[model samples]
Target: MRITVADPAVPDVVALLSEHLADMHATSPAESVHALDVERLRAPHVTFLAARDDAGDLMGVGALAELGDGHAEVKSMRTAHAHRGAGVAAAVLDSLVDAARARGCTRVSLETGTDAYFSAAHRLYERAGFVECGPFAGYGEDPHSRFYTREL
Candidate 1:
């Protein structure tokens, strides 16, 4: 798989992001859904990534939003449903962490849903050295949210 910064104007990227957003809303409450929309992902502070197969089919997506102060937040992570369990999410995640380290971030964190829909994400983060942590950045304590952080 090839991972690169996603172009917001690309149709495939747009559709994949739409699917991702629908999944988040399907599993989490409106207030609990932290996934960024295409517009937010286009902000200068965010670096959105897309993983694609050799044929250029989008397989997964993730983003790292620079939070300043040596910290960054992982955002909008999702693997194509058809590609689940094929390691696409892990690859995208590893690349985002690498991007964080390259940008001089000391810690990277994320806010994900606490529901069963997030189980795979929790497992992926844990295996990659992330640990449960209190919310960082502007986030507050919420029953529907689970936070994790990892030091680079």
Candidate 2:
């Protein structure tokens, strides 16, 4: 799969992103939804990417949000339902981490749901080197959330 920073106006990327957001909202009621809307992804601090096959089919999407001072947050990670378990998410995540590192970020963090619906996400994050942590970057403790952080 090819991973590239994208302008949210790209039609394929926008459709994939819409599906990603809708799936997340369907899975958890209390997730700290990231601001992945088109304009938000174009913000100075955010770097959004969409993963695509050679044929141009979108396989996954994710973004890295600069939090300043060598810190960044991972956001909007999602793989197409049919592509789940096909390494699409892993590829996108690895690219996001590399992107953060290239930007001089020393650490990367993320927020995901803690409900049963998120167990798979929690597992994936752990496998990717994220460790459970208290809220960072202004997020407070919330029973509905699980926070993770990793050194880049």
Candidate 3:
């Protein structure tokens, strides 16, 4: 797969983001969900990355948002339903981390649901060197959420 910084307004990327939002809503209560939509991903502080297969099929997407000096948050991480377990998400995640590191972010953090539905992501982040932590940036403590951070 190939990873590239992308324009969130692209059609396929927008569709994937829509699916991600739907999944978040279905998995977590309204107030517990933190997934960002296409418009939100376009914010100036955020950088979007896309993963595509050898055939150029959209495999997954992930983004990093500048929270403040030397810190960033991972946002909108999602592998296409058909691409899960294929390393697509991992590739996108690594790209985001690399981008964050390049931008001088000393720490990278992410928030995901605490439910079983998010176990895969929890494992992925753990394997990528992220460790569970208390809420960071703009988040508050929530029993339904799990926050993680890693120092670069």
lDDT of 3 by residue, 1-152 (tens): 89998998999999999988998999889999998888889999999999998998999999999999899999999888888899888888889989999999999999999889899999999999999999988789999999999999
lDDT of 1 by residue, 105-136 (tens): 99999999999978989999999999999988
Query: Tell me, what's the RMSD of every candidate?
Result: 0.9, 1.6, 0.9
List residue ranges in candidate 3 displaced over 4 A: none
Q: TM-score for all predictions?
A: 0.97, 0.91, 0.97
Candidate 1 segments whose C-alpha is farther than 4 A from its true place: none
lDDT for 4 (candidate 3):
91
Pairwise TM-score winner, candidates 2 and 3: 3
* Pairs of residues at least 3 apart in sequence or in different chains that clash in candidate 3: none
Residue range with the least summed lDDT across 10 consecutive positions in model 1: 6-15
Judged by TM-score relative to the true structure, which candidate is superior, 1 or 2? 1
